[model samples]
Target: MTQGLDQQHPQEHRDRAILETITQEGRSDYNLVELARLYIRYDNFPGARQIQQDLQAILAQWNLTVEELFTLTRAIHQQGQIYRRTKSGEDIQDWS
Candidate 1:
């Protein structure tokens, strides 16, 4: 006769469950820069401006500059484009 065995550690099982939940819920970017870009790209100017205001509030909270925020926004936009292209299986041509 054969006996059944329990193989999963409690912590490992909990971690896997948590990860599955998060993956099913999808990715969320709470960063204002990314939120603003999403709004702007979709032609939601009012929403984008609202997010900009929120970004300003965050900047004030962290004592950061508008220039730094712009830089972050640019980087996020670049990464988004790359991600989109990759997801769509489109060839990205480098003209540099």
Candidate 2:
């Protein structure tokens, strides 16, 4: 009998473990879209919410406003947006 994804990870009992892997394991960092999918995979919406809050807190450390983070997140692509240049072909700067 096969178990589930939650049973696969060693730290399944630890709620923080999932978030920790996002940073420590580095494979699942940010990537909220991916994280959401992962949460769905594990059938863990509650855990997903916790992870979302944790990620938001981490990003808050950057002093980014909610609007800025919203713009940086690509909902259509379901991925994080990394801006290298503005629409005018200039490098992005002075983002707060």
Candidate 3:
């Protein structure tokens, strides 16, 4: 299942957190070209700047541009990664 960015997994490393936070939620397909814009929007919030820096570092490490990373993430998310859960905390697949 595609994990929502609102909850951080304890085992997730720092670089992974940055990628998930910026891309995994709250986006329009049209905004993919401007994916980095959210960093500017959230810059005033506490800890956001550090995230921006970390994202840059991750890009450098992976030798990827922002657009490339977005494409990759979008493909992964599209591949049946998203799932729904019931309010009682049951997987949707269980109800099928």
Candidate 4:
């Protein structure tokens, strides 16, 4: 039974272990964003909301206005999509 369970969701177990390590190291906005992404990917909306709250707080503390942050987030998301589509796995090239 234990082996069956282990084999059934190996990636989930790995993700949990990684999350545990990150939590033990203490939470940060960057960590929260990563957690949110992981939760979203796994279809865990509640967990993602919690992380999003943390991210909001961090953005507030940094005095990042909502528009600026949204712009940054959109750019990052778009870049990731482009990289994934290209399959070259290269970093996004700087325009300036």
Candidate 5:
């Protein structure tokens, strides 16, 4: 239950780091998007949706254009397709 970062597999360590940062800052469009993607992959659908809503609010606060929103959403979707966000925190490369 309490694995040390050094003890974790490299991929697991990186995965845990990302999750931690997301919780710690939970700010910035980039971080939110990444967290959302991870949530989606990890089967936390509601959390992912919430992050998306947060993303929308962030975009609105910045006065971004519809075109910008479309672009960002597209990129996020594409990434979700590319990366298999697993709860195990396994390294993507290790899949091979």
Candidate 6:
């Protein structure tokens, strides 16, 4: 039988504790997007309200506003990467 995450990885527990502390304090020296991704992934977990507040606080540190961020993300998804890996100037038909 597999054990729980806290039991299997003690370091993970310590890291989570540190993340919780930073989130509650609304501060992080790490990449804001990475930190925000973690919070977003656990949005339905305990202390969700605090997570939402922390996301807003972190976003304020970024140069782009919420709308601008969304717009840029949308553009990237729509336009794909700046460079293609294929030598042929045709879209790869078989994604599989």
Off by over 4 Å in 1: 1-30, 34-55, 81-96
Question: Each candidate: RMSD to true structure?
Answer: 17.2, 11.8, 12.1, 9.7, 11.0, 10.4
Winner of 1 and 6 under lDDT: 6
Instruction: Give the C-alpha lDDT of model 6.
Output: 0.47
Cα lDDT tens digits for candidate 6, 1-96: 222321222233443554566556653233333354444454444343444455566567655466655555555546664334568675432211
Better of 3 and 6 by lDDT: 3
Candidate 5 Cα lDDT to native: 0.50
- Give one digit per residue, the lDDT tens place, for model 4 in 1-96: 232332223245555564665566645444444444454444423233434455455446556655665555566666554332335655442211
Local lDDT at 26 for model 1 = 39
Query: What is the alpha-carbon lDDT for the whole of candidate 4?
Result: 0.47
Scored by CA lDDT, what does every candidate get?
Answer: 0.43, 0.45, 0.47, 0.47, 0.50, 0.47
TM-score of each: 0.31, 0.31, 0.40, 0.36, 0.33, 0.35
Residue-wise lDDT of candidate 5 within 2-76, one digit each (tens)?
Answer: 223223232444555666666567556566456445434433232334344544554465566546645665777
Query: What clash count does candidate 4 reach?
Result: 0
Model 5 CA deviation exceeding 4 Å by range: 1-12, 44-96
Using lDDT as the measure, which candidate wins? 5
Q: Which 10 consecutive positions of candidate 3 have the poorest summed lDDT?
A: 1-10
CA displacement after TM-score superposition, residue 62 of candidate 6 (Å): 0.4
Model 3: per-residue lDDT, tens digit, 1-96? 222323432323543453565455534432332334443333343443445565566556557787676676567558742446679766543110
Candidates in descending lDDT order: 5, 3, 4, 6, 2, 1
Backbone clash pairs in model 5 (N, Cα, C under 3 Å; residues 3+ apart or in different chains), count: 0
